[model samples]
Target: MLRRLALTAVVSLATLSAVTPAATAATGPVPLPLPLPVLQDDARARLTITVSGSEDSAAEGTFELRCAPAGGSHPVAERACDRLDELAGEDEDPFAPVPEDALCTLQFGGPATARITGTWEGRHIDTVFSRTNGCEISRWNNLIPVLPNVR
Candidate 1:
């Protein structure tokens, strides 16, 4: 009986060793792909700026901005690219949404509008900007470096 009990214990230990690894592996965290930054041949963006309404003078023009060896028609390519990078680093989407409950004055900063369409950090970006209210005005101001001289 002693020898039989010893053999049973050994068999049980072997079975446990064989099953433990498979069970642990089945419940382990899944291997997922890392979020990698996009690579591009060139970092370039075409921008359009337009201002409307009588409160502010009207201005409109189109220009290009480039970075990673910053050189483009944009008056401040380096500054603009730096600002863009800062904003992009904050979140996956650079154009962050305005908070709904945030308090803002009713003051109008004119009907300024901006349109950007190009590649950023190897990703295609097509976004619009408008200053119809306080929040929009703040957003437009934040992007002033890249935008045309609409002010």
Candidate 2:
């Protein structure tokens, strides 16, 4: 009986070990895909994101993020300036000069906070103010006038 109990314990331990990691990976430290460029067109548009546990992160590349109108509706990335322009007062040129290589940074342990003072708009705007934790612009979000060739 003891031996059978021991075997059952070992099997349970192995199964738990295998299953635990998959659950963790689902919410593990997701590295930066690229620098997400979020549009900052409002003074009260800054936000903070928090992360838990210990993880390392690095910048991937330049990412352009767009924000929704005042009501926080949220914008979609890569849709097209033709639609975004109407709301932004003017259309952003898809062919604008964005840093081809901007990296995102991990802010803190437990809860990271990402702040911005600009408008982020690509095809779709990332309205979920994530604690992406890297803002290169101060006071006003870095402005890369939407050009007409990047698209």
Candidate 3:
């Protein structure tokens, strides 16, 4: 009876040992596919904004902005990112310059000037903003938190 019990124990141990390796192998780490460069570009957006000549001293400075995963030194990063995304959906170019033939009011908003440089939706962007005239002021105002509120 003792010998039979020992044999049963030995068989059980062998079965467990054999199953353990298979179980571990089944649950082992899985290899992940490499990320596509274009997908990565589409997933991330980064920008640098510099503001000067504004009446508000707090608004004059350089700021960093990131989107898709929204974060940065920009005061309203999430709002700015959302605004950009909304513009994109509407097929609007945020950095487009006012047309030469377009009539603009001679109104002088301010001496405020801003420069934005960065990447958005996989495209490079380098644009300037100023509150010199009505058209330009409207454009600058459209950008809102992204360019900082001059008034």
Best by lDDT: 3
Worst 10 residues of 3 by lDDT: 33-42
Write candidate 1's Cα lDDT for 1-151 as tens digits. Answer: 6566667766776776677777768897444435433432544443333333324332455667777777777667788878777876776465555668988778776656767777776666677777667877777777767764444
Residues 28-140, candidate 2, lDDT per residue (tens digit)?
A: 75443343234334422222122122132422122333333333212323332333444356455322333438664544222222322233332322222222344322101
**lDDT order of candidates, best first?**
3, 1, 2
**Most TM-score-accurate candidate:** 3
TM-score of each: 0.55, 0.18, 0.72
RMSD of each: 17.1, 20.6, 15.5
How does residue 129 of candidate 1 score in lDDT? 75
Reference-based TM-score, model 1:
0.55
Every candidate's lDDT: 0.63, 0.34, 0.85
Model 3, stretches more than 4 Å misplaced? 1-43
Q: Candidate 1 regions off by >4 Å?
A: 1-40, 44-59, 96-104, 148-151
Q: Between prediction 1 and prediction 2, which has the larger lDDT?
A: 1
Residue lDDT tens for model 3, 30-147: 4443442231343456999999999999999999999988988999999999988887887778789999999999999999999999998888899999999999999999999898
Better candidate by lDDT, 2 or 3 = 3
* Candidate 2 lDDT (Cα, 0 to 1): 0.34
- Name every residue pair that clashes in candidate 3: none
